[model samples]
Target: MTSNFRHVALIGKYQASSAGSTGDSSRQALEDIAHFLERQGCEVALEAETASNAGLTHDYPSLNVDEIGARCDLGLVVGGDGTMLGIGRRLARFGTPLIGINQGRLGFITDIPFDTYQATLSPMLKGAYEEDLRPLMHATVVRDERIVFEALAMNDVVVNRGATSGMVELRVEVGGRLVANQRADGLIIASPTGSTAYSLSAGGPMLHPSIPGWVLVPIAPHTLSNRPIVLSDATEVAVEVVSGRDVSANFDMQSLASLLHGDRILVKRSEHCVRFLHPQGWNYFATLRKKLRWNEGGS
Candidate 1:
């Protein structure tokens, strides 16, 4: 079949060790997928870090993330959600669409199963696919009116007290209006795409990806009445560390430690969004049911 994506970038989990069992399997999968893409009339390139960590020595060109973003029409991420999250954030700026092949547990965003990837991916290459646009959150840590750290999160932005520290006091604001002053273990500012991640575990609602909203969930709040609240994505949310010991902020996998009093975490919707391509007829609810085992005991 003729491919809609002529130049495709293949990214594997770089953290996998070449000598480990998982790495060996991932390497084999990458090779097989590369060959399959070739047969589909698509030119494939290996992501530089994937090539190095997987010990790949294929004739295909190995390119960095910037190169892939500029040149490739599609990015096929072969790993778990974490791998996809890392690449998604990087590729969002370039507007390059992505497809995820599940190589790790709890695929979530990486919904394609390895065993059936060839069957699923072939049609997608031929323009038979579903497009999903997931929004990203831009988080910044501001201290004393200066920007200290900044990152993009596809999941959630978290603020937490140190492991040994007591509860943190955070003053929350939305659109420059005071929302609350809560004493809690921490706070989570999660985008719709992040609703099912850490936020879900912290008692936040599971928001559909199509929702244009954010969920604020407090972790172990001292007040029982403190509950998760959803707000429109158009507004900016600020969380200031009013009082805490060894506080920190985390944006998805990226973290900034040693937060002091008055350090404010600013979160807003990013202008760029990640685009995911799935097989035609893919349904978000179906994915949730399958992954969450919602029908495990159904007849």
Candidate 2:
């Protein structure tokens, strides 16, 4: 038990992928979670879309993302990591802490399972949980020294070619020093929290979440000599589109911005960090072992 959370908000994925079509299980889980929190003597609010998806009655209150951020003591995300990503990025600016209840595949960031909700959510609501602060990246695309596009990404910021089967060149600089002139499909600048995401799939090393560094992984580089590099959190990275080809800068593989020649995308650590509340006995390594099947030893 750490901090008492009195006001809790609920958010989840809109679509469910089970049982042909009814999606009764997923919808019931949301209703039960809401009622459970209310019974625990905590005020609960649901995000507008989540309320709509769950078919909540008019008696239940609903708040938009901004309202939830401004008021709720904690937010409970009731879906997969993607749902958390969307909510976390939005709430990060308000410094709101979030807890995730797994209802989708992978559930990497959504640590709690639907089956364990009865046992986990109650104790966790009573202040039995671990709080983890994860740093996010604030990325901006600057064309001619003026900011053109900006967004926050909880995972990795990707600069890749768009809609064509060809390689693009990117000139990478960190803290004003040239790091590489990469000829590749793209470059992924990922926070440590994103190490196991797109970066890992592109052959980047897995970074522990506590690491105060960012990884730069080149995607399908023309030369094998070009490899992934980790930079200190303090370092400011700038990537220029040197190949004169149109490239896209992606935030958490969601929001996108198009880049042309002379466009430079800047990536740096965000001032605000997202806080995750995990249930007691939640182990990161154990989660990795289960999700990734590390112990099965099948290379």
C-alpha RMSD values across all candidates: 1.4, 2.8
lDDT of 2 by residue, 1-299 (tens): 22277888988786653344445676687788888888778788888887776677374789999999999999999988888999999999999999998865557789888877878877877778888899999999999989999999989999998666589999999999998789999999998778889999999998888899999999999999998888898989999998846688999987999998889999999998999988888778877887887884532
Instruction: Summing lDDT over every window of 10 consecutive residues in candidate 2, give the lowest-scoring window.
Output: 14-23
Q: lDDT by residue for model 1 over 115-134, one digit each (tens)?
A: 89999988899899989999
Q: Could you estimate the TM-score for every candidate?
A: 0.97, 0.93
**Candidate 2 — which residues are off by over 4 angstroms?**
1-3, 15-23, 296-299
Task: In candidate 2, list every pair of residues with a backbone clash.
Answer: none
* Residue 215 in candidate 1, Cα distance off native in Å: 0.2
| TM accuracy, model 2 | 0.93
By summed lDDT, the worst window of 10 consecutive residues in model 1 runs over: 290-299
